[model samples]
Target: MDNPGSQEVDRIERQESRAQDLHLDRVVATQPEIGPTPPDGGYGWLIVVSASIYHITVPSLLTLYGLVILRAIRDEEHEEEESLKIWDMDLALVPIIMLVIRLLLESWCRAVVKIFNMPRFMALAGLCLTVAGVLLSSYSTDTYSNDHIVNVFAGIFAGTGCALTGQQTDVIITHYFREKLTIAQRLVRMAPSIGNFLAPILIGYLCTVYTGDVIVMIYAAILMQNCLFLASYTRPIYIEKVIRTTYNMLRDAADDDDEVIYSNPNQPTPAPTTQNPQQGTSQDDDNDVVVFNSRKNAREILDPAVQYRERSEPVNNQARFSSDFSAMFAETSSNRFSSNFGSLDVINYTSTSRYQELESIDRDSQNPQPLYRETTVNAPQNNIVFATEPTAGTIRRTATLKKNLITIANMLMDINFYLYALLHLSTTFSILVLGVFFPAYVWLQVPSQTIWWVATTIAMGHGAALCFLMMCLVLPQNINEKTRLCAAFCFVGALGFYGITISGNRSFLILWCMCASFSTAASSILQQPLYNSTLNEFDTTATITTTNAIVAAFVLTWALLKNYEYSTCFLTAAILQAITAVIFFALSFRRRR
Candidate 1:
């Protein structure tokens, strides 16, 4: 038989070894399960092609068709049908209606995605509705008022379909692209220019030849078939199941033991204990478990080797003390500021673990200087890093919905929202004045040159879009600088619009149109990346709020300016744009500093 003291020592040693093994296992379990890499190319190209086609066909077609319908209404046979006063309202309302639906969808897209499982299904449904609407419009042989109602229904279908389909393309591209994302985005953005140029001419000719009803039927047939091709390419990935499985396994393991391994090194160490001779066998056994677990935890975290290594290192005591003082002051100030902001606070949560702190110090010591630096390097982990996945299990849908709603609310509270909204509003006003009123103004100025007006508008818009496409290809993806550059360009466009007010010559008008259009196109393209950058700087991910706010601004400004004369509207647009540019410049400058 073994000696009693030796037996007790052996039992204690075994328990200590078990505790270390448990600690090591916990560390190993904490590592994330890496998922499949995104396919940067391959079948993604087909999706890109489909997206291009959709972009080229849908938006351009609607714009062209709207204008053509307007023209057709104006040119309607008086004997065949009564003139409809609602035609003008129809022309303006079509795009506005489309925009409102798109905005609404955007606001709730994440929830929709969660509920529907995929945007592809929504897109397919939208396609069906679009076809139905077009068919209804085509088949209708009702009075002017009834026909107008049918067209409004058609507008609804086209708007919802185009929004859903168009947005899904963006989602797909973002999922696929990584390194050449800018190039892919540029191609996607540029596709609409082709539609913009060709759609007007094609739709105008088709209306001239076969009537608008025939044109609607043709669009219905073409889109219904094209949507099938689009739907075929859309496939969903099931990484969520894998993530859920991994999470369940981890959680089960943790629940198996009452005393889970504590990874944090900063917590106060528990006192060591020994089994009491007078205590019952079960109590003695429990005491042994607690004593050994506490001993092993302390040894692992507060190892003599690590402590000596840390103590032996050279440090400037003055600098260390200064840094500590500054960090304390900063923390106090941040807490005060956060209290003021309440739920929308910019929380700076540092890991309280000494292990993490030591690791960070080691990294800093190794890299005296890094070639590339992220602004968030010195920021608290919670500020920039989102813990999207939980340690327990898959996040509940209810929780996700609540979280997304909170994010949206916080984003609305951000100052950047107002600034971006202003910028978008100014740009939108200019585009509206150019698109709706410029042609009419040209007709008034030179009724003999109606053909020239159509040609010039198409040429200028397409050319400007092409120029922006080239810029996208050539320019480096510098989001901050691009925002400033785009702002400057917008200012130039504003100046051009202002110049139009004073000028009477056709050459100047054409030149101004070209300049203004080019600037607007460049600004529009750059705004996507610019908005992304601004969101990053704000440390928020609520794109829908930004979009909604911008649209709201547009709606407000449009309401104020819609009844004004074309010249007066343009003049107001210029003034507003000039103010926006100044504010943007100042804000950018301040940010750089």
Candidate 2:
């Protein structure tokens, strides 16, 4: 016969066990679904190809403004002083307005992704808008009267399209490649440089052959080819839906009940099990076994005891338990158990302490007993059922939204991230300001015979820079070092701009163009890697939007200053680059100390 004290202990043990099971059930029911692992290769290469095409086409359009679009607009300008003022404003404002529209669209990219559901669809929509904008700009003949207004709308549409296409392409490429991400990024980065190198030569040649409107239409036709390439690629890899459990909360609750639960803090948290009403007994039933169907396999059972017994079986063949309670309490814990479910150990009720040492669990070696027995009955072919309550879904979405908001807020608060953004914006601002005004400067200052020679020199410089960046990517330098090197290159480019201000010699100007293009290419290639290494939590969409907004503000200030003089513009760009370089050097020095 059992002693009265023994009976009381057994009753308390049963109550504790029931409480743990209830807690697990509650946690599992509220958890969201986890996506399957990335294939990391497969059709992802095809995605890279499509993304390369997008980079080649969309971003390179901006480069054409200096060669073709701006020249066309300038040619249409009237001789009146008011017309010249309006033209000057258009030159400053067009790119700024374009950047502003792009900024706004990119900032709201998350919402756009939700609406479109896939990057391919978003790319398609952006393509249509871009083509329409090009056609609209081509329709206008006068610059001061109708073309200026039409060009603003054109910039808007083009900016919107470019933002959507660029952002969505990034998402698709990132989603596809994991292990080979660096290689893929290098290849994609190379595309823009290739485009920049080739676009000027192509546009310059086309301008000499075809009229401006004809050239615009021809480019629009070229842009339309992306639709074909995009459609050829298949959808992204299939993701398996698995429950995500909150292990920390379970651990805390276990501690509150004076039950010890063992878990490796380093191990990933495991998914918890929900009480399945269809394939298993009701909560009121006293049966010791429970069975549930996984979405991936209908015949699979999620029993920890069964999983432990078949531990020697291949991972693909083993049942995917919500939590491997048995394995968690095994003699030697392995990383295998932690991979599926977060690390967890069976509850130890003997100790009043919330956490007992692993060595203290000697009862398992002396007289082992399974936490629960498994009965393997055939599971019916049914879908993985989830909580049908509307409130649960709403609550989960609200939590996700709140978490994202907090993350963005935290990123915004970080001084390092803010400084990094300023550095990027300053570099981009100088590049744009130079690119927009450089052609006009050349036309005015350099002799007519040297203009085409200067254009060829610029194209060759871009090509050489592209090749150099490709070589740099292949080298073994770390991101931090590469970023510093790029900053130094910016300083060198600033010196190049200053040289341009001091001399109108074609040979010197050619040298300056090469330096500037080299800096531009290097900055473009390293930007993503630096962002990833510095602030992994910050969203790419948000970064682009924030930087572009700041750039637009700077451009607005320049416009208001009414400093369109070529010498002043080049001087201003050089000053901004110098400041950016100095700040980066200071920040890097402080970080090292």
lDDT of each: 0.58, 0.63
lDDT of 2 by residue, 1-593 (tens): 87999999999999998898765323323333533345577888888888888778766666655655345544655232322222353434445566667766776765676465566678788888877776666654234434567778887888788777767776677666666788788788778777877877777777677766677788889889889877744445342122113565566666552211232234334445457777673222112234332333333222455456667554445444435454643445433445443333223232212323333444456764322111111212221212344688899999989977877787788765766676676666666755566665655554353335545756776776676666756744355564466569779878877877776676777777666766766766677677767776677556666666776677666666664565677787788778777777666666531
Runs of candidate 2 exceeding 4 Å displacement: 1-35, 73-86, 89-93, 140-146, 240-413, 450-454, 537-545, 560-563
Measured on C-alpha atoms, candidate 1 has an lDDT of 0.58
Best by TM-score: 2
What is the alpha-carbon lDDT of model 2 when measured against the actual structure? 0.63
* Root-mean-square deviation per candidate: 21.2, 21.8
lDDT by residue (86-177, candidate 1, tens digit) is 22334444445555555556545544544564756866776776567557656432224334566567657766676566666677677666
Clashes of each: 0, 4
Candidate 1 — which residues are off by over 4 angstroms? 1-35, 73-89, 131-152, 216-222, 236-413, 428-441, 450-457, 496-509, 537-543, 549-553, 556-565
TM-score of each: 0.60, 0.63
